[model samples]
Target: MNSGISGYVIQRLLGTIPILIGVGIVTFVLVRVLPGDPAVFYVTGPVVTQEAVQAVREALGLDQPLYLQLFHYFGQILTGDLGRSLTTGQAVTVSLMQRLPASLELSIVAMTLAIALSIPLGIIAATRLGTWSDYAIRFAATVGVSLPASVLGILLILVFYYYVGFAPDPIGRLDPFVATPQSITGFLLIDSLLAGNLEAFRSAAAQVALPALTVALVVMGPILRITRSSMVDVLTSDYIRTCRAAGFNWWTTYVRYGLRNALLPVLTTVGLIIAYLIGANVVVEKLFAWPGVGAYSIDALLASDYAPVQGYMLLMTALFVVINTMVDVLSALVDPRVRAQ
Candidate 1:
């Protein structure tokens, strides 16, 4: 079984290379094809000239043939060079490394909230299929699924900002008044805790909570619904009935027998949710002014910064692939039939 799993993992990792190349090609072409030139976007003042635009294009290697440009870009990436940002002229990899942790921390918190809330709610809903609790859970999940993220974000902002007055300003990851902690992981919350700065940690948490919650609320609904449905099916299986008939208590039958089987499907959905959350962070990040890769991608798009945009797309694609592969492996482990096949 270990060998089989290892082989499977190796195969998936090998497959990712071609997938990443395809993603790079598609993203490169799409960004290039988009209306407006990056050079012109950067040059806005009276000092802008045709020569300046050409110089910008040359600096970006936009003057090369399409295929040659892609080859050069790929070569640079292979050597651990992500190139300079068009807007800042700083190294793209460095910029991403600096900003990625804040987004990752937020995503972790949001996904943790989503899984913690969804699984139990789903299980309860499924267990009490015809009860008021079930109905209430269903209604809540429906509302979560139906509401747009933008509206949800606005509502959260209003309630927290106006009603509570404890909300932090929607600008970057930390307040300007507070000094940022030393960059260990680049995650303010973790760094603050590590550095023993309680105030910094509190500030980080306050700033992150709204955006994270906004993302969680939007993502939690589908996970809840899917988990409920899967749990319901598992509960109806013969093993569960047999367990009940064998005089096992309701809790044991439901939790041990039913939940283990139910979790296979839920795990699959959760993996997808994680992937979607990574991509969907764009709007939440923007609304809250969180410095994440999603926001970086948006800024790159607005400025037509192809390198950063391409890098972002490639990173997201890689993440999705890795997550999906993990889900597949986990599912195989949970379901013996997959390994048997």
Candidate 2:
């Protein structure tokens, strides 16, 4: 069993190498093909001289042959250098390091919120299939799926911040008056608590709640639907019927047997949800004025700064690969059939 698991994990890791290389190659080619010249965008004045634009292009290595540029980029990537941002003049890695934690924190919180609410509701709806409870849950799930994150975010701000006056200002990560905690971890919520700054923690949590909720609402529908369908299938399986006939109680029969069997599909949905959350963050982050990589990438994209956009795409691709590997391993552990395969 141990050897099989090891083989599976090793195989997954090895397979990801080519994927990363492919993503890097595609990102390099696609960014170069985008309209507008980076040098022209970077150099701006009332009357910009051709010499200035040419100099900027050379400095950024944009004047190099495409093949040479690709080789240089791959070399830099191998050396753990993501290159400098043409707009900000900071290392792309540095910016990612600073901003990724924010995006991750938001994603984590939203996923937690979604899973916490979705699974139980799904179970209830499954157990009560054909009843009013199931219909209500299904209706709500449909609405959640249909609602756009941007619209939901604006409505949340209006209802909670403007009308209700419960939510904090829909601004950055924390209130202006709150002193940011010392950065032990880049996550504000964790770093605040680590530094024993409850005030900052509360402020950060409040600021994150609305946008996180917005993201959760957008993702919750798919998770709930998957869980409900999986559970319904498991509960109706022959083994479950056997358990029901063998005098096994409801808890042991459903909670233990049904939920365990239902988990694999739900787990897969969760992995896909993480990717969706990353895309949703691009909109939610901008709406909330959150300083995360999604917002950072948007700024770079508007300026046609190729390095940062490439860095963002490569970073996100690598992240998805890691998530997929973990999901595969977890599915294997959950079901012996997957491990045997």
Candidate 3:
């Protein structure tokens, strides 16, 4: 078992090196290839001088040879310096640190809601099969899968803002007047709670909930469908039948034995869903004007800010890789045949 785990860990880690390099190379090329020059954007004048643009480029180290620039960027990345944003003139790392907390909080809440809603509904639907509850759940999942997040965000805003009047203003994470919690890991919700500032915590949570729900609605469908299918398959397995024949109750057999085996495939789907949710949140964030990393990345792209864009891309790629690696490890652990030589 130890050898198998060790082998899997080493192989996965080694495999990730190439994947990271490929992602980095692709991001680097794609950002540079995109239209609009950061240097040009940085200079402000009716009569833009070549010297001004050159100076801006040189200051940003854009004047350096492409390979040398990439080398320097990678060297800084190793030292945890992601460089500065051309648009904001702030450190890319600092910007990410400031904004990532909101994104993380939102993602976590959305994921929690999705998991909470998906699993039981999926199990119930699968168990009931042709019943009305099953049909209703299936219909809900279909609607969720079909709706775009932007549309959902808009609908949520309209309902909450116009009809209900319960949601906070559709603006950034919090009102500018409300001072954010001091950066302890940058997650405002957590930092505020840790500091025992109930007001800040409440404010953060209130502002984040709607956007998080929008993201959750966008993510819940796939998780529901995958879990339902897996549950059905596992419930009908020979071992499950044996357990049932041995006088085990339906819920016990389903939850204890069937669910455990069913989770392998569901885990894979969940990982992919997580990756998709993170990517899809960009649209949601923009619609809600939430000051998350996705919103920051979009602004960076619009301004041709390469460093932040690169950092954002790398961060996203790293997250997806990590999630995928975890899913693979869990799946292998669940299915012993996967670890067989």
Evaluated with TM-score, which candidate comes out highest? 2
* Model 2 worst lDDT run, 10 consecutive residues: 272-281
**lDDT of candidate 2 at residue 282, scale 0 to 100:** 93
Best by lDDT: 2
lDDT tens digits, residues 1-341, model 1?
59989899999989999998899899978999999988787766788899989987897678889999989989988987877787878888888887778778888899998888988899899989999999999999999889988899999999988788879887878888988888888889989999998889999988988888888888899899988999899988899889988999977898788888888778888888887677778888899888899999899889888888888888888889898999989889998887676
TM-score of model 3 vs. true structure: 0.90
lDDT of 2 by residue, 77-183 (tens): 99999999988889999999899999999999999999998998899999999999999999999998898889999999999999999999988899999999999
Better candidate number, 1 or 3, judged by lDDT:
1
- lDDT (C-alpha, whole model) for all candidates: 0.87, 0.90, 0.84
Model 2 TM-score on a 0 to 1 scale: 0.95
- Please give each candidate's TM-score: 0.93, 0.95, 0.90
Model 3 accuracy (lDDT, Cα):
0.84
In candidate 2, residue 30 scores what lDDT?
89
RMSD of each candidate relative to the true structure: 1.9, 1.7, 2.4
Q: What's the count of clashing pairs in each model shown?
A: 0, 0, 0
lDDT of 1 at 233: 92
